[model samples]
Target: MPHPERNPFVFSDARFRKFIGSVAAIGAAALVLVGCSPSTDQGGTFADDGCTSVVVATSSEKVNLMEDLGAAFKDSAEHKGLEKCATVHAVNVASGKAAQYLSDSTTEWALGADTAPSVWSPASTVWTNRVASIAGDKVVAGAESFAKTPVVFGMPESMAKALGYPGKPISLKQIHDLIANPDGWGAAGKSMWGSFKIAKTNPNSSTTGMSMLLMQAYAASGKAQDLTVADVKAAEEFSRVFESGAIHYGDTTGKVLQNLADRTSGKGSSYVSAIALEETSLYNYNIGNPDSHTVQPGETLTPPDEKLVAVYPSEGSMWSDNPAVVLDAKWVTPEQKTASAAFVKFLHTKKAQELLPKYGFRPTDDSVDVSKYLNADVGVDPKQPAVTLPQPEPEVVSAAIDQWAAIRKPSAILQLIDISGSMDESIGDGRTRLDGAIEGSTATLGQIRPTDEIGVWAFTTGLSSNIDGTRVNGIGVVRPFGVLGGDKEGLQSDIEDLANSQRAGTPLYDSISSAYDYMKTHAEAGRINAIVVLSDGEDTDSATRLDTLIQKINADQKEGGNDKPVRIFAIAYSKAADVESLEKLARASGGQVFDATDPAKITETFQSVMNNF
Candidate 1:
């Protein structure tokens, strides 16, 4: 690049040097443009040519792979001797979230599993073509198979045997029969009851959720005959079977995997449900197995009896191929795009794809077999790559997901705030525990719909426990305070007010106990009632012991009582914050215990709870 001091006319004419120079400047600019027109190098760096970085937005599940894949192309210990190639960033997200972020100009590349991601690869061509119709710009079909594995119906082997697995093949109808066994309907169609249950991933978050919905639709419409919409709608038994089984249905496939893992962990109960989930996640445990044998990396064994039976489902089965997507519109550059492509390529490479097997996911590469990466005892049998995968129209698929979302049960949430003195201490963002509690509670309310009644309760003062004759639980007071009628602005305001004006007390027992009673008394029948309590201190004030509260809550729930037996969640603000208490309370009510010492991260914890709900 060069800057000219004077134009040709300015140097030749002394009279009108300024004017001549201005005129000459135009001439010089035209000459420079002509010279730079693909003839000469007019730019300083080739990076300016727009081939640097490429942003690929993707499902959050792929974020790990994306980062790992990106690192491999750099030639350090992880990527030794490799060129400074394009970077790959996987924009992982919740199930439909990628689709929503894709239309925005910020994310030029969208990655995801199934119809959500527009980039074509694996079995994504059809999805890409369809999204392009509405998304406008056409996407390039990149070459590579990052991970390929069949989606299977996870269940205990004993349960599978009862469903005609050992001898006769179990059809979709049979699976339905097993789930609806305790619940039967002649008009809906039932050959026999296998006495098993059924569950599914949340249609809102997991890719398996998408797969499950489409499968149900196909099965309902009689995919055996390439079911039509009319056929699906006319089949009254369809909704019946789908809704009957929900033993461990979760917001994400990972959550479902944890549910399965937790059940058969040690002397644990097993779910006999025909839960639809990805084989990949089934073997990847956040916590290792009983023996070093199955816990070894790249090792996992099937139970002495293979509880998991792959049911292609008499109808079409769909696979989830999540893609990477970028959302920062202003920041998505060519460099990021290149990085994304490189990342995809790296993932498809032999070394990386091999990691899929340990997680029970089969790789797409032909050079290597999954058995090497799997502990045969606990691994899924994904042979011949899902020989028959049917692709239904996206509209049909979307409609099925929509229907599932609608039919799902509503959530009754209770926010149990710890208003003890310890909450007065400031936790990040310059906000005290009380302030954090209020902020988190109010924000959580904003995320939920009004149909979802979120109630807030605080535990403090002499009402902390069941002392003497009081019905309260521990001193860690957590109860309902603010309640909004469904989703509304006024309701939001009321929740905010409750958060601000909450009375400080050390009697956590009173709040949690009363809130449970309130929910039990007021909750709409059939909703999943749950209470979430956050505390920064211990229970020094509860008059009632934890045992009494648990006993009462359980008894009341078993037999209808005022508290109606609600799920109680315990969230400790820190490690010193009485983990034992939270765990006991949470276990009693089937609620989870979360350690949330930082109020700034309260939103994340709240969101996690919301997802599970």
Candidate 2:
């Protein structure tokens, strides 16, 4: 039990500096994997007359800053007479993306935003430490705070008044209590001393959003003043409010920010505000439409706080660690590696550091005046400075996220698998699509317990169970669309049994619709509900057809599943597989699609289904 150095692909290698020096492309690739990708075609690999280019891998937010930052480095690249240059292809590589990238050995460096790569950007110190831990004992890497602002509780002025505005720092205890005992808040609707709402991400993604939940868990459980599993379960009290079945799946920082402007979303709700939100988002929100319907105000708990104040959870909060490292892949050159290092150094220079104000970033240099950037820049009040956070061992934290997942809420799921023709093709290593499907299905089953429910439906010869159709037999029955039934144990048996009895052809369409039908029938809000569909090929057999089911799924994602508008995630198996169709199905259900042959990646696919449910 010392923290395993295995680095769960999401993040690997405790030592930061040396790793980058070893692989230039690794970092850049990590960015891509995490959904923080920068576009290419800006510059080519090797420039004329010995100039070379290396990939700067990192998250989109950091990648967004690359244009200006990268360009500035371009000037230095020319000035230093260095033959190589660095171009950032902002791969959307987040922590989860990092694991994939490292496993595959792509990209140059893994650049992140917070000091601690795992959580939100509490302050410069927190970001620095996590990256250091990620870099481990040897690498001498330092976090350069380019810009920063405190995370403010963006509540209406009225809500602030209800919570005792302008009082000492908001007590985390109050927030935890609200989540732990939402019923209490209901009785005291006018409760003013301290008002709070739950802020969370799906835990599978959104490091910062997860941070908010963890802090609360620690406070609620009170197992230790320092962060621990006990504290996390206690903080899970926030999920209690969700048990009412209110929280939506996969609402990250961006969505939460949008919800903040809408006051009607009563009681426990709000995002930790940042300075550099999407420029166009704020512009549009402030502009309002012709009817000005969006430009309405509600009884604010605290009138929109003018100056930014990052409320460090009184019990303590977590920080985000965004590190800029180089992957140093075979494609990289020594010149490119040096350029990457110089680029990082440039970010700390006066010109780049000055950007902290306008961009809503807090400067790492203490000497600079953060206040000057207040209104003129992002309107982030200069009063706040970067906060320092404790760096808990990564292993303990990983376990915390799991415990958080458990105590939060139970999930209900329906597996809508496509039994089409292409499942017949041989994947690499002599495995068929169905073989992989069975592997994934088997793995998914082992993870589920009684609290979780799963159902199975195999489509090929007919809509009934793949085996002999026995009414309510241990195996689930297939219907018109792709739907299944029963608890975890029951569902697992059905899926495994269905795998055993699958015919040569895959009935993709029928499977999808049937699975969807189950969700509609059993639709319950508190239960995390979804239907994960997999098709090795196209929909050959389906009385209803895949197109019709897709349209219905699309309509549902935009509008919440009233009874159970199931979120659908899909896995496109094999090389010739119809990824487009699979992707379309997933998007309709607010899920994403995956290519089965590529690295046999089920991380995103499996994660999407589990997290959404």
Candidate 3:
């Protein structure tokens, strides 16, 4: 039932031959799980019933599908034959985060499921390979493809037509050239479309971003496979050119797609010309479900007026062979392993494979037809991805990530912290809301390169002047913008001083408007120019109205044809925080808002926001 010809994991390189061989052995075993009655246990532990409890930690995109399959498998004769031996739980975990958790022994696996996973199925084997390289071979012994989707450039239908898509394949080199050209879409004779902007996620945190990085490096080396460390080094300049076109980076692609969908609804020009996404993601976007979350029954789906079509690179692209990997960890019991294998076998059945296409995924079992779902109606081609770039050695993949860090666009960030009276309220563990925020902000400094430009501002009503004797306003410049390499210590000190600087009343509107204007005036080219706002309450003192501030942000975003748009990334720090206003401000400026209502999670939320830079 397996389609060898359609399989993209076939490796010709000697380095990965053994790995591929092991994968085949695993696949042949049909190792998976079968569902049973739901457990009424806490902390991801199995109820002390006679059945084995198998936990499958999967990437977020496949959680619903896996859950459905598990539910269906519960009633099968195969499960009944085993006397309901196993109860399976599918939990959502980001691929990159899962790899990080497995790599670090001390890190607790508190990702939704409180217990460590018996099996880990990330989006691609790339993650499994990374885990193996860092945590040792014993961590991820082997993995097999469960479903497949190729990385692609999701572009508006009109834009794809202009680039000769469908009629001709678009190569990565062509995309790089377009990104480097100051003329933007003018090179394609569509000046009205404006500059060529792209939305790319942080490679360290996203599978699509990792695939994009690898493919771009391979394209630069002029090789279809067998990429080397030298090739990645040689492609630094090329990578920089392509990265320069990015409007911003995030931990996930959902934000990018959601932004595009929002623009479509508003009947405005798309925020970005293209976004790096999986083929399934493009299909979902075409159908107006850009976030690709499982649509609930009775939910009305509205297709976007402007659909996004997939452009498989002629130079060759990569596939996310959603590999189901049974972890070889001490935590996994033999019984759980057996149940895991059974679950994977159930996934390969015709019934299970048939459901994959309905969700915009290609079945790993080639016998399952995909033509019905992957068609022009959904902005995808069933026969696509004729050529897949070979998987490089794990070392090469690691080196590419390092090279990306060096060549990726730097950021210019101005952080605004609310020092209102409410910030003094205790969150828990003897820490105030301000204390948690400061901790998160301080930690964020280490996440960015020293070459980045950084500054800080503290705001509260009646704040007339700063430590630097700056002019009067509702806010004070705790630290002026400077190269982070030189001002790291001073910035840290300024942030610490904020704990003692709490004052009465929040001047939210005035602070954001002033910060926005300042950032726009000093916006740097070849970097992410933006403001980061962390607030714990609504505006209590400000001359500027919310509507007036939004209008100013909109006007600035549209100015100079948006050549240097300054984005505003806001974090609502507590339930009392004004989330709706923050969302509007962030959306207007081409940035996204983060919800941190639970102050205890501020540290995690802050790091996520920093990934944008």
Find the candidate with the highest lDDT and give its number. 3
Q: TM-score each candidate.
A: 0.67, 0.62, 0.88
lDDT of 2: 0.44
C-alpha positional error of residue 586 in candidate 2 after TM-score superposition, expressed in Å? 5.4
lDDT of 1 by residue, 1-613 (tens): 1111111111112332332232222212211000001110111211233223433434434434334444444432323322333433233344444333444433443321221222223223234434444565444333334665455675554455445554555566666664555433222232232234455656554567666666666666655435445544554457645654554345455434433443423211222345676555543322122111112122322231133444545454666554332222334445444444445555656766654443345566767765543433343454422334565665655566556655655667777667666777777667777777666666755446556666555566743344225565433323333344544665456555644443444666655666667666666544557777777777666566777887776565344212223666667775557778776666555455665755556765665566555
Can you write out model 3's per-residue Cα lDDT over 1-613, one digit (the tens) per residue? 1111111211123523332233223213322222123322113454444566667787656755666666656655446556346656666567887888888862455543345678788899999888888889877886878799999998887788889977989988888988888888899998776788888889898999888999999899999988999999998898898889888898888877877777624323437888899998887666556676544433444566677888999888899988887787767778777777777767777777876875678998898888766787677888888788988898888888888788888899999999989999999999999999999999878767889888888899878664334475888778887788866777778898888884789889989988887888788878899899999988889889999998888777665447778999999999999999998889888899987988888987898899899
Give the runs in model 3 whose Cα sits over 4 Å from its true position: 1-53, 85-87, 112-115, 264-270, 330-335, 466-472
- TM-score (C-alpha, index-matched) for candidate 1: 0.67
| Cα lDDT for residue 146, candidate 2 | 46
Work out candidate 2's RMSD over C-alphas: 12.2
After best superposition, candidate 2 residue 208: deviation in angstroms? 1.6
The lDDT per prediction is: 0.48, 0.44, 0.78
**lDDT at position 498, candidate 3:** 82
Off by over 4 Å in 2: 1-50, 77-83, 97-136, 139-199, 202-206, 217-318, 326-337, 355-361, 365-399, 443-450, 466-510, 523-525, 536-565, 572-604, 611-613
